[model samples]
Target: MQTRRTFLKTSGCLAAGALLAPNLAKAAKVKDIGIQLYTVRKEMLEDATGTLKKLAKIGYKQLESARSDKGNFYGLQPKEIKKIAGDLGMTVRSGHVHIDKDWQRSIDMAAEAGQTYLVCSSLPSEGQTVANYQRCADAFSKAAEACKKANLVFGYHNHEYEFDKVDGKVLYDILLDRTDPTLVKMEMDLGWVIVTGNDPLAYFKKYPGRFPLWHLKDMDKAKKESTEFGKGQINVKQMLQNMDKSGVKYFFVEQEEYPKTALESAKYDYDYLARLDY
Candidate 1:
């Protein structure tokens, strides 16, 4: 039987020794591993095609692109990026972008890229009051409607600031309570939730099935920066155990600031996740 590993070993693109010994088919291993391209943005900026090939080699089966100075796909058109990733045996499931006046264009690009979700990276307007969040919720609902027209789901990715209090209520809760769950899905960033003194498990309990996407980042407790999986304060293994409760369908590995080279950190994360059983 010429398995994928055997084929890769025979083809010379993959070294037999470098492969992770545990097969993904093993029970309890995460079925689909993904990475947010931002983790390797520098490499992409230098050589997008080369970077993607490296990621595919690293065993990232799915990707979520981050908007860069070059363009949404490091200057590659939507269809171009889609084709490139397809050839590499990976899929781009989602991306981060601002909900702005050109949002319609963003929708068009996501549709062209053959992505399932288009996430608003942050609040389009400024103001942390309840009224502001309500207004943003209204806007996001509208944005979701537009995304539906393009056959895409609309979502939001959170940072630490969303946890800040607006009056007596948590601003993030406002966004959740106000938005129509069917229209707006939240991409909870687990690391930010922990670093800011919030509990992701509680959110799962509070808003069951509201989060469909995730940025599974690990954070350093003291430095509050991203660290290699096990070295960080975050309990990556424990979080994976609760994926069902969080309603996560697609989670991407996101490391913002790492101690080693970005690609090295990414590789370490890849191995750590591959070893995880939940």
Candidate 2:
């Protein structure tokens, strides 16, 4: 999405400057930056309201929730989550859910939460074969159509396993080819893609505008665990520069293996994205 010229105004120094310095900060930024609730799972589980308020203060204005043991919305009702975030100048944008037999309830809950997208956090079926992937695709189509009727979008988030070679073919790519791009959108996890020895840019090129959501994570290349933003191997700036090709509307920063407290790591991640230009 093209950013408004006025939105480019930022504040920092010149040589090392990143703000209002249009020359330094350059064009477009991820306005309404978001975070996956899973990143702050511990804090959320402890105090959902307080934790959300803290994220809002750090300038993360959008959210993507995960299905937690405490239940969706971290023990709060769907409307309560929406109300709380809205009270803090943030929005509940998307959520990670399982598209299982209780999917209709998920759709209902997501709609009630006032979020735009309901993402299947993992594959519904349990096999890695082409037939299995195809079956998943068909199921996804049906699920997405149901979402369409409810005025919502349905998508899937990938782990490294999706890119594994099956019958000499990339299973993730096969699903992409098999599904209707309009119906079943994808939420590309950059860290997983990179860790799996795949190129996210290649996917963008092959399937332009197919991805609308992303998990913006940085992984410790050596350990394959998530770390603070700039401390990892993901070329975040490069990816941001080419975001248009990926058709990204919103991306949620996620870090599972933190160097410190989850909340502290979250704050570090928020600031990292804040200073970047692309």
Candidate 3:
């Protein structure tokens, strides 16, 4: 059985080696940033394909899908979505999915759709105890194993609750400690980390290359909701600066609550990131 401590040690060495890898330098150039479709949920609900085309026209190169009323890929079949996004010169790299009885179906659909990641959008159960987190990790590891067989990566996205302490230990740490690094990866939500008064960099330093995906969001301190990128307190530039440490291969901009229309906020976020120096 692979223990968490051993997994961390092995993953740390791999992360250190990856830091000097040529690809790390290449990734620093910031090419093809993606947007999570949930940011424009209303528009997507109205017209999924058209909304995607608009995003592509706005210079988005990648997309992450969310479960919608129509289906997991917004009313379109998996292959249909892949074709549409491909036609628009954008790839559906990942999607937010539930770790439910239908998980294998989700994985199969993702594989067929050419998606590289199947991220569990939230914790499957309600408990916040360490034991509960451990159980979740075990379940995730099994799911990840199945994902590997399908040639897809399995990841978990976090919210503020994961940061709460249980017996002087962070619940998120328990999950990271319990899961196999090779089997499971993290999609760090930058806004939620700040909202919980935790630092995303600290996790990057602790887990190194384990975080390959990110929800690059900013939070309005006053409203405790996602806002346009620079309008929030998160130091977007600083987070980008530590990409090497975080080992972020791809990131998706996601905003849950916007002052303007979702499409307009999405455009604003794209422009903000495009103009960012790092």
Per-residue lDDT over 24-71 for candidate 2, one digit per residue giving the tens place of the 0 to 100 score: 446765577899999999999999999999999999998999999988
Q: After superposition, which runs of candidate 3 have C-alpha atoms over 4 Å from their true positions? A: 1-29
Q: What are the candidates' C-alpha RMSDs?
A: 10.4, 8.2, 12.3
lDDT of each: 0.89, 0.90, 0.90
The whole-model C-alpha lDDT of candidate 1 against the native structure comes to 0.89
Model 3 lDDT tens row, 1-278: 88999999999999888876765564544578999999998998899889988999999998899987877888888999999999999999999999998898999999989999999999887898988899999989999999999999999999889999999999999889998998899999998998888988999999988999999988888778898988889888889988889999899999988776998999999998887766
Each model's backbone clash number:
0, 2, 0
Model 3 deviation from native, Cα RMSD in Å: 12.3
User: On lDDT, who's better, 1 or 3?
Assistant: 3
Off by over 4 Å in 1: 1-27
Superposed model 2: Cα runs more than 4 Å off: 1-30
